[model samples]
Target: MRQAARSYSVQLAIIGSGMAGFAASVFALDRGIKTAQVGNTGAVAYTTGYLDLLGGDQHSLLTDPWRALVELRQHEPRHPLARIGEQEIRTALARFTHAVSEMGIAYTSPGETNLMALSPAGTLKPTCSVPRTMLPGIEAMTQGAPTLIVDFDGLKGFSAAELVANLRDSWPELRAARIAFPDLPPGQVYPEVMARALEVSTNRDRVAELIRPLIGNAGAVGVPAVLGMHNPDRVQQALQQLLGVPLFEIPTIPPAVPGIRLREMFEQCFPERGLTLVPQQKVTRIDLTDAKLRLSLRDSYGEVEILAQAAVLATGRFLSGGLFAGRNGIRETLLDIPVTQPAARSEWYRERYFDRRGHPLNRAGIEVDDHFRPLDAAGRRLDPRLFAAGILLAHQDWTRQRCGAGVAIASAYQAVKGAVEVIGQGSAATRG
Candidate 1:
C-alpha cells in the first residue's frame, strides 16, 4: 500500500471510538465542526444494541429511570451524569440515537420509563431504548405472546432451551428449537458470520423458510442477534413478512452481531459524512500545549500527526486500555492524567465478589469539573483545550448502575460543547 499525508488539521480531535468517542464526533459533526476521530472503535462491539440511561442499581430495577436520575444526583453529586443538566442529558441521548438510526440500524428514542428487553441468558435488561429489531421482544415477553426462539446448530453460548427454561415462569408461551444455518462451510457458527450471510436475499429467504414451519400458531419469532449486519431493520422486516410474524433479536455473546454492526457502521459512515476517521487505529501520544493540541499515531503505511484546537479523551476503562491497574495503583494510560482511585491497592475490593454495594475499584477514574474538563489535584482544569468523558470519569460504576451508554453519550455532548467553545474563542482571538 502507498502512504498518505503524514499530517492533518482539524478543529477537534476525538481520542477514542467507543460510545463516548463516537458520540463526540457525531455531536461535532452536527455542529458543522471540522473533526478527526482516531482510535479503535473500543469496547463498543462488546455491547448489545440497546441504549441504556440509568437502568437501575445493584439492588433494584428502576422503571422510571428519569426519577431515579434525580435521586442519583443527590447521592452521587460527583457522578458524570449529575454534573450534566437533566434536559441536556435527555437531548444529547435523543440526538445520538436519532443520528445512528439515520445512519443505519434504527434505535428507539429514549423515553420516560426503561424498556424491558431479554438478555442472551434470558434475564430482563431494563434499558432506556433498544433497536427496533429487538423492540418486538419487549412486547412478546411482556404480553406472554407465543414466540418461537431459535438457536443455530453450531452457535454456542446462546441456547434456546436454556432461555425458555429460565423465562418459562413469566412467559409460558415461549418455545425453543434449533435449525442449521443455510449455505456455508462451518465448523463453528458465529453470529457475525450468520449476520453477514443473512444480508444476502437468498439467505434470508432460506432462514425464513426454515423458521416458518416451526412457528405453529406463534405470533412472533426471536432469534439470536443474527440479523443482517449492515441492514438489520430491513432484514427483520423482510423476514417477518416471510414468516408472517413479528421478528426480533436477542443479544448474543460479547463481540456479537449488535456491537459488530455498530463498529462497522461507524467505520463506514463517519468518512462519508465528512468526518476524518482513522478507524481501528490508536493514538500513540497526545501533546497538549497552551497554544494547540498535537496527536501522534502510526498506521500500517506510516506515522501520522494531527493538530487540533481541542480534544476529547473518551478512551473508556481498563477493558479498552484507557486505564492501567498496576500492582501499585491504577494509572491513566494515554495522558498520564490522574486517576481518582482508592489510596491503596488493598482497598480496591470487598471480601465478597457479589457484594451488593460493589467494589471501590469499579469507581476508579479521572475527575472532571462542571464543564467536563479533567482537573488536577488543586481542582483546576488540566488544560483549557482538554476534556474527558465516559466511564473514565469517576464516581459511579457503569455496569452496576446501568448507565454506561448514558454516561458515554451525555458526557461526550458536554465535552464536545466545551471543545467547541474553546475553538470558537481561539477563532475570535484571531479576528480581534
Candidate 2:
C-alpha cells in the first residue's frame, strides 16, 4: 500500500481550551496562523455567560495593567511580574477581545472596566471583573445606596439571611428581603438551576405571576438566589415589566455553570478554524530538550506524546493543577517553570477559607514577563519557546477587579503574538 504523506504540520499547540486557550487560538488564526487546541471541560458548559471586568469604584485599577502587575509582585512578593510592560498588556487585551467578537462571542462593553454579574439571587453585583486583584466586588456593593438582599427558598451555598445580616451590620441602611421562586423544583439548592431557567425561560407570564405581589412596597427587588440563569437580559426585562422594580443578582457557590457557559462559547469556535482539541487529557510530564517541547499526556484516547515548537500553559492554579502546591508550598507543574508563592501553603490562605480577608490561595500563583513567558527561579526566561497566559501569569486578582476574562483575553493575545514571533516565518514550525 502506498503511504499517504502527512496532511498538516501544527504551527502551535495549545494545552487548554478554557478562555485563555481559546483566545490564544483566535489570536493566532486572526494573524493567519494555523494552530491546534486541546483540553477538556468543554470551556462553555460550566460558567456564567458574562465576561467579568474590574468593578468596584473604590479599588481603581492601576492605569497600566503591566505596572500594576509589578506593584502586585512587590505587595505580595510571590507573584510573577518580570519584564512584562504596560503597552503590550493593553494591546493584547484590545486585539484579543476584538478577535473574540469577530469570532461571534460578545463582551457586552468596551474599555478596561467592570462587567456587572447578575447573581443567582436576582441581585446585581458590580464585581471588579478583572483577573487577580485584592478588592472584593461583593464588598464593593455596600457602597451603593440602600442595598437589598434577596433570596429564593431552596437556594444552596449562598445564605441570604446570613449575607443580609452581615450587610445590615456593616451598613445599617442596607435593606433586605426574601422572595421564593414558585417554579424551582423542591430540594434544588443550587440557585443556578432557577437562575438558568429564568435566563431562557419562555415563562415570563408565570414569573410575573410570582413576582408582582412580593415587590408591592419594596423600592427594589433583591434576589440573593438564582434570579435568571442564561438569559439575564430577558429575565430582568420580564421581572421589571411585572413588578416595576429594579432587580439585582448575587453570586452563590461556584461550579458556576453560567460562568462555564461563557467558557464554552469560546471553546466551540476553535475547532472550526482547524485547531486540535483534546478533552479530558492531562499533561503528565513535560521536557524541554534540544529546543523542542515534549509533552506526555493521557486522555480517553489513551497516552500519547505531543511534540511542538511552542506551548501555552493555561492549566490554572492549584484547583486546576497547572501549578501545584505541596507541604513546602507552590511550584510549577509540567515544565517546572518558576511560580511565585508564600513561604508556606498555610500562609497561602486565610485561617478560614471563607474568612474574606483574602488569602494567598487567591494570590500566590504564577509570574511572567511582558509577553507572558515563564521566568526561572533566578528571574530569567525559562523557555523562549514557551509562553504563559490566563491565571498562570500571576499577580492581580480577578475576584477583586472582576477582570478575569479581560486579563485572560489580554494575556492570551500577547502570548500568542510572542509565540508566533518565536516560531518566525516557517510553514512547518510546529510538530503535530
Candidate 3:
C-alpha cells in the first residue's frame, strides 16, 4: 500500500546537510526566512571540527589567510573564495561559528592567523577556527609545554605513541600514555561510545582518575576527540577540574566524535529554532515552476514534498552524490546541471600522483555566476530562485587549497542573501 505524499511549504529549501547547507539555514534563519532542509548523511561527519578558511596555496602553508586571499584573487580569480570579498567571507564564518557556539558547541573565534591544528595522523594543518576544547592543545604544541597524549587500550586509528613519535623532535617534552576506558568490554573501542559514556559524571571521574596517575610532570593532557558528544566543552572542563591540568583533544579519524558532535548539535538545535529539518533523507526529484520550487523525496513514512520560494543547492561533490562520475565524464546529479570539467577522463589526472599542480578533476564542478546562481552551458542563469554553494561550484581544488569550510560557509551566505533578495522581489511583485 502506497502512503499519500506529505508536503511542506517554506520561503527557502536547502538541499545538502553539510557545512554549506547548515550555514545556509543559519543565514536564512537570521533573516527570519522559513526554511526546510533535506539531505542524506554527507561528508560533514568526516570533518575534523576545524573551520579552515584558505589555509594555504599549493606551494606553502599560509600564516595569514587574509593575505593569501589577495594572492588567490590575483592568481585564481575564478576561484569561489576569490569571487567573494574577504570581508563577506569573514562575516559569514564569524556568524556561522557564533551560531554553532550558541547551540552548545564552543568554537574559538576566527583569527587573523591560522591556528596550527593537530590532525589524527599527528600532522599539523592550518585552520581558521577550532573547537574551544581543542584550543589548549594548539597552544601547548606551540609553546612546547610538557604534554601527555593518552590513547584508549582498544581504540583504533589513534595511536598516542605515533603522535608523540612524530611530534617529539618538534616538541621535546611531549609524551604518550595508554589507558583503559572506564567499564568497557574491549576488543575494539569506538569513539562515539566513549564520548557518550563520558557524558555521565561517574564515567568522567573514572577516566579522569586513570589519566591523573599518568600525567607525570606534564602540564597538559591530549586525548583523542572523544569528549562528551553533546556538551564537550562542559565535559572537558569537568575532566580538567578533576585531573587538575589543562586538557585538549586531538582529532580522531573520520566519522570522528567532533564531526558527529557538530552534526547532532545542528540536527537538534535547528528544529527548535523553527527549521523544518528533514535529516538523513535525500531529495529524489525537484520541480521548478515560475511561482515556486517543488522538491520530492521519501522518508520512513513514504513520499514527502517540499515547496519553497527559493532553493539553495549545497549538495557536495563526488562523495556526497551531488556530482556523479561516469565512465565518459563527470556530471551534476540533480537538475542535469552542466558541469565545468575536463574534456575527457584522461585529462582528469596528471601523470604523477602527488603532483603539486593538482589534477583537473579536482576543479570539476557546476559553474556559478557572480550572485552564486548556477549558470547553464551558454552562461545563462538556470533559475533566478535557484542558487548553488559549496564544493559543487567550479574552479579551485578545496583539498589542496585547504579551504573547504570557508568556501562552503561563505558561498552559502552569499547564496542565501541572493535567495532572500529574489524572494522579497517576488513577494513585492505579487502584492502589486
Q: What is the TM-score of each predicted model, taking all chains together?
A: 0.98, 0.71, 0.98
The most accurate candidate by TM-score is: 3
- Which residue runs of candidate 1 sit more than 4 Å off their true CA positions? 1-5
lDDT of 3 by residue, 1-432 (tens): 767799998999999999899999999999999999999788999999999998867788888999999998999999999999888998999999999999999999999899999998789999999999999999999999999999999999999999999888899999999999988997899999999999999999899889888999999999999999999999999999999999999999988998899899999999999999999999988898647899999999889999899999999999999999999898899898999999988899999988988899999999999999999989999999999999999997989899999999999999999999988997899899
- Order by TM-score, highest first: 3, 1, 2
Each model's total of backbone clashes: 0, 69, 0
Report how far off residue 237 is in candidate 1 (Å): 0.9
- Measured by lDDT, the strongest candidate is 3
Whole-model Cα lDDT per candidate?
0.91, 0.59, 0.93
How many residue pairs clash in model 3? 0
TM-score of 3: 0.98
Candidate 2 ranges beyond 4 A from true positions: 1-9, 17-19, 41-84, 94-149, 159-179, 199-202, 217-248, 287-296, 303-307, 340-370, 376-380, 394-407, 428-432
